[model samples]
Target: MSTLSIRDLVVSVETEAGAKEILHGVNMDISSNETHAIMGPNGSGKSTLAYALAGHPKYTIDSGSVTLDGEDLVEMSVDERAKAGLFLAMQYPVEVPGVTVTNFLRASKTAIDGEAPKLRTWTKDLSQAMKDLRIDPEFAARNVNEGFSGGEKKRHEILQLELLKPKFAVLDETDSGLDVDALRIVSEGVNRAKETTDIGVLLITHYTRILRYIKPDHVHVLVKGKVAEEGGPELAQRLEDEGYDRFLVNA
Candidate 1:
């Protein structure tokens, strides 16, 4: 089975004030058939773990290891990691000027597959994916993320997840800024990807609303950069009902 193992991961970032630690001794495991949710307060390092997994150069891995099956993912470059079956849906997708959505998606798919997708089939798939995500067909000609609303940008990320079919996806606060309807659409897209490909999901979010639609198999409460507690969906319910005050108090 394909599995992602993260052990005692410590990460830091450089600022004008010098290096600032984010994730500290964080550990988790996700299998292809599982969906894991990480819930935490603001600045509790949930996003840090996501960015670190994607090999963002800004986040320095201070120690520990991340492995996919038997291969060392921490040693791989960003593109290498993508080719190795890793995907990260960023919190804020940036604008890619002068590139159409169709070309961008096709190019990325080519990069990971080492060959171009069959034009007719790729077109059909892209069209269907956009329809499933409720994206406008005309969006194919627009530059990626340029002039797109927040919902549209987030939808594009989920669109990539569906098309790329990564072995594991780190969705960093994907629920943020989405209204009820938009959140449901994006969550549905994620569920579709996971069911079709058996892709493991490392979902990072502060609220449990997204969990209502995604239904994580495991829930982790992150506090002060480490996992303070973990359990089944029941844990998420408890956190939602009572809030993270207890966890924050301890921290």
Candidate 2:
């Protein structure tokens, strides 16, 4: 089974104030079919961890290691990380001015698989996947995330997740700007991807609303760049009611 193991990961970021550490020895392991949630207050370095995992170049790994199914991701480039079955759906997906959604998706698939998928099969699958996500058929011709609403962009992220079928996905604040309806739909798409591909999820969010739809096997509360608490689904409910005040206070 595919597995991702992060051990004592210490990350730093360059700021106007110079290099400052964000993540402080984060330790976690996730295998296929498992859902792990990282919840914390704003500026708690939650998004930093997500970006670090995806090798964004901004976050530097000062110490520790990240391994996927025994391969060292800490030594891999961004695209190398993706080829190793790692995926990150950004909170704000950037627009590709001239690349149509169709071309982008197919190109991404080809990159991941090292060979182009049969055009006929990919076409059918893409159509069905969009329909399932309730996306407009005409969207295939539009540039990626171009002219799309917040909810549409979020759904597009899921579409990539569903199509790419990565072994692990780090969804960073995917619910940030989504409404109730859009949240439900995106959450359902995540569940579908999990069930269909047994993909491990490292869901990072500040609110528990997304947890209401995508149940997590493990919930970790990141406080001041460290895990202050961790529990099952019940912990998420507690976080919803009590907020991160208790953790922050104790920290």
Candidate 3:
């Protein structure tokens, strides 16, 4: 089993007026077979944390280190980090005009795993995953997120997670903009992935609705780029009742 560790991680972005820090010495660890929920309001650097962890170029690491199973992740490129067993499902999944779902999934799998899957077995696996996620087989022929609804896009992300089978996944606000039915389907997909792969998940969200379905192992309240409070599932309930006011003050 692999573990993702972040220690005293500080991230900054280049601006017209020098560097602007977004994350402030954040620290956390996620292990295989565990799920961690990061809850915070807008502009609290939740997305920045996701991007930074995924090795996005725009976010500069000012200090500290990110490692996976004792391997240094900060020294790797985005593709390298992905090959090292990290995945990020973006909050806003992009529309790639000419790429079909099948091609994209195959390419991503090849890049991360260093070997192409056999066509016959790959198709069967893809079909089963799509069915589990309640995605239509026709979607495999369509362009990636080109005309997908919010929930469809989210499901597509989960489909990638299922097919890629990464060691750790950071879902960046995937519950956002999804309708109730869509939310349930998406949540079910996530649950299925966790069950099948023993994958570690860092679910980033602002509300507790998704938590109700996924049942996080740990819930953390992130305020002003820091984790202000950490606890079990009950912490998500308290945040739902009290909002971030208490945590914001403490942060």
Candidate 4:
């Protein structure tokens, strides 16, 4: 089984004042078909960990080791990391004005596979995925995420996850801004990916509602850039009921 290992990962970002560290010595291990939910308050370095894993330039890896299987992910470029089976679904998906959804998906698929997908097969897969996600077929011809609603953009992110079929996906607050129906649709897409590809997921969120749809194998609570607590699925329910007050008071 594929494993994504994070060990003592410390990451920082440049600010006007100076470089400020965000993640402080975090460690976690996720394997194929395992869903690890990262629940934390705002500024707990949840997004930092996601971007750090995806090799975002803004988040500098001060020290630590992140590996996919045995290869070091810290040394790889962002695109190289994608090719290495790491995918990050951004919290706020940016719009690509000139790139249509169809073209962008095909291009990304080719990049990760190092070969283009056959047209007939690719088209059918794309249509089915979009349909399953409740995305309108016309969305394919539109520029990627251009003028799309919050739920639409989120669905687009999952669409890529379904088609690209990465070994691991770090979903950074994917449930944010999604309504009940949209959330269910998006969650189903993630579940579909896991079932079909055995994709490992690092699901970051503030609520347990999504966990109801995509059950996590493990739950981690982050406070002040450190993992404050870890447990099984029950931990998520505790967080939902108790909130992060205990963790915050202790932090």
Largest lDDT belongs to which candidate?
A: 4
- Residue runs of model 3 more than 4 Å from their true location after superposition: none
Between candidates 2 and 3, the one scoring higher on TM-score is 2
- Ranking of models by lDDT: 4, 2, 1, 3
Tell me the tens digit of each residue's lDDT in model 2 across 43-138: 899999999999998899999999999999999999999999999999889998999999999999999999999999999999988998999999
Q: Would you estimate the TM-scores of all the predictions?
A: 0.99, 0.99, 0.97, 0.99
Q: Tens digit of lDDT per residue, candidate 3, span 1-251?
A: 88999999999987899889988989899999899999988888899999999988889999999999999999999999999999999999999999999999999999888999999999999999999889999999999999999989999999999999999999999999999999999999888888999999999999999998999999987788787889999999998998988766666
Worst 10 residues of 2 by lDDT: 242-251
Query: Between prediction 3 and prediction 4, which has the larger TM-score?
Result: 4
Candidate RMSDs in Å, in order, are 0.7, 0.7, 1.0, 0.6
Query: What local lDDT does model 4 show for residue 214?
Result: 98
- lDDT for every model? 0.94, 0.95, 0.93, 0.96
What is the lDDT, from 0 to 100, of the residue 236 in candidate 1? Answer: 95
Task: List, residue by residue over 150-207, the lDDT tens digit for candidate 1.
Answer: 9999999999999999999999999999999999999999999988999999999989
- Looking at model 3, the pairs that clash are none
